[model samples]
Target: MDVSVFEVIGPIMIGPSSSHTAGAAKLARIAKDIVNASFNRVTFGLHGSFAMTYKGHGTDRALVAGVLGLYEDDEAIADSFELAKQQGLEYEFYEINLENVHENTVKITFLLEDGSNYYVIGSSIGGGQIIITNMNGFQTEFTAQYSTIMMKHYDRYGIVSEVSAILANSHINIATMRLNRNARGEEAFCIIDTDDIVPYDVKECIEQLDGVIQVQVINVND
Candidate 1:
């Protein structure tokens, strides 16, 4: 595994613990990014060490701060709960045991304004690093370490090829891609991590392709 300078020397963040605070914020931020919609409520299922010491370690505040789109280093993290209330974001945290996962894990459930709900399960892997283990109902995994694109679409032949072709045409180098489907001819999920940033128009092109139902991108540099 490649380690970043932040991992080795620790990230510059407002934190009592890197795993609990900074990583929690990062995970929440990425989860918010994937939704790409307004969510009025978010429920947090805390597990293991996170459930045990979250309040004291400022993990709760960090998570709320991130959902508010505050960076990890932002001083506003100290007052995330109040800020969340002011911003019309409702949140609640519950302690729960998760199976076969890292110690610092949290399940974020989002209730969007459109009467739809989404969920993401992620673990803070220490030193401000995080790995998103699952999204919606798909058993997907990604670190969000690069500019990532995630989509849900109908399962059918040529969808992947067409999307990749668009990426290739745009000169986007795909570093990794994962495809998953619940069953043949059913809904599917695709995650593509690119070495270079993908332009908005390229994403729009993919969306216009037949079979694509939804697409969301996370530009790490943003």
Candidate 2:
């Protein structure tokens, strides 16, 4: 039997624990990407394995650096908090129980400029694979391994189906998806995971779609 791609490379990463460290970083990065304004403050809640060993395993630092837009392979991960401070970002950390969630999971809440706020819950499944379990109180999930992910811009008269249709036309197969909208419904975002590797051409095509203001590729080596 042919091994699924996820099965082959899902457990290895440059960290003490693939789920706690790498997963935490990916989750923080996703949250950073979705916020429209500059992030001024961040709060992280750790659960399971993340809560148990985040400090020792460098999970906390990894997460902090990721939210600050640093890549997984960045050498500065160890000094993420200091770096964030230098960049005028502030953060706090805490431990919480998620009630029946994975051991290596965390919740992050961010306060951005203009008084906007966002929250995210995510888990690191061993290897380098991570799943975003929730965003802004919405039950959703996404894999960050995709080469291209379309993040919908918040606006009135937005139709999510149109975004899906555009991907279908491009012959892209969506592996997973997660959506979040503000309580007022004035702001919204969708994180899409696709099977097709994203190239510049494909990214440009998606950016042209209505309501899509940005197409970002989050990867370790990008």
| Candidate of highest TM-score | 1
Candidate 1 TM-score, true structure as reference: 0.97
Backbone clash count, each prediction separately = 0, 4
lDDT of 2 by residue, 110-160 (tens): 987878788888888766677777866656666666744746566546456
CA lDDT of every candidate: 0.92, 0.73
In angstroms, how far off is 25's CA in candidate 1? Answer: 0.5
- TM-scores of all models? 0.97, 0.73
Residue range 1-222, candidate 1, lDDT tens digits: 886788787889987888999999999998888778899999999999999999999999999998889889999999998998898889999998999989999999999999999999999998898999899889888998889999899999999999989999999999999999999999999999999998899889989989999998887899
> How much is 21 displaced in model 2, in angstroms?
2.3
* Error of model 2, residue 80, in angstroms: 1.5
Residue pairs clashing, model 1: none
